[model samples]
Target: MEIRALVFDVFGTVVDWRSGVAREVRRQLPGVDAEAFADAWRGRYVPSMDRVRRGEQPWTSLDDLHRASLDELLAEFGVPGVPADARAELVLAWHRLTPWPDSVAGLTRLKERYVIASLSNGNVALLVDMAKHGGLPWDTVLSAELFGHYKPDPEVYDGAARLLGLPPERVLMVAAHTSDLAAARARGLRTAYVHRPAEHGPAATPPPGADPEADVSVASLTELATRLSA
Candidate 1:
């Protein structure tokens, strides 16, 4: 089936989360190792969401989860005395993430050809703020918060398709993570893997190559736009 809509993963796929978070950390906690702190905070993301997925907690917004993780990290990193206002501002770091170089231009091109939207684990408010901050021209935003389930769960993939009023196969799920794409594929969505080698920072190992199961794989969103003739 021809894809009629493209739903993108936000964090590391569209925005450079590690660098953005590190930048915020550096500003907020002068003596801290910003990069390590950023990595540690992000490292808690999946596990925190997993708690909700497993019914261990009721639906909690990504912002709340991020704040919770930040609180824990402050103590863990020996900076437990951070003022509440400062901590709240730090949690907003995710809302002000910087987009990758190709993100806005590539998405703009894709938007000209198909319905383009965000399908992310981040809450709608966070996604909206990020879009405004980065000048991302999404036709709309869809998020796990809407479905009360995170990526890798069928609900998020299926919910996006349902909300778009398209059959699963008529929507392409774009992401930097194979696990996310694979889950989307399992729910009958087409998949594109966009490589983000610097997502976890330069020292982290990048994806070795394209995902064998992805319908398309490319080095950037611009390449994805080209592959789809957007």
Candidate 2:
């Protein structure tokens, strides 16, 4: 089936989360290794979401989860005495993430040909703020918060298609992570893997190139647009 809408995974796929979080961490906590701190915080993302996914906890917004992780990380990193306001500001770092170089222009081009929206684990408010901050031209924002389930869960993928009023196959799930794409595929959505080698940072091992199971794999969103004839 031809894809009519493209729903994106936001954090590592569209935005440079590591750099943005590190920048905020550097500013907020002068003495800490900002990059490492950023990595540590992101490292907790899946586990935190897994809690809610497993029904171990009720639905919690990504922002609240991030805050909870941040508090634990602060103490783990031996950076105590951070005021409540400061912690809150740090949690907002996810909202201020910068887009990758090809993100805006490529998404703009794709938007000209297809409906482009975000289908992310991040809550709707955070997605909106990041879009505004980065000048991302999404047609609409769809998030796990809306479905009360995170990526890798069928509800989020199925919910995106339902909300778009398109069949699962008519929507392409675009992401940097194969796990996300795989889950989308399981729910009958087409998959596109957009390589993001620098998502974790330069020193970290890169994600595998071109997922074998994806309908398409491209180096950047521009490439994806080209491949999709957008």
Residues forming the 10-long window of minimal summed lDDT in candidate 2: 221-230
Q: Give a tens-digit lDDT track for model 1, residues 61-158.
A: 99999999999999999996799988988999999999999999999999999999999999999999999999999999999999989888999999
User: RMSD of each candidate?
Assistant: 0.7, 0.6
- 1-230 in candidate 2: lDDT tens per residue? 77899999999999999999999899889999999999999999999999999999999999999999999999999998999988988999999999999999899999999999999999999999999999999999999999989988999999999999999999999999999999999999999999999998899999999999999999999998888887
Instruction: Give residue 26's lDDT in candidate 2 (0 to 100).
Output: 90
- Candidate 1, run of 10 with poorest lDDT: 200-209
Best by lDDT: 2
What would the TM-scores of all predictions be? 0.99, 0.99
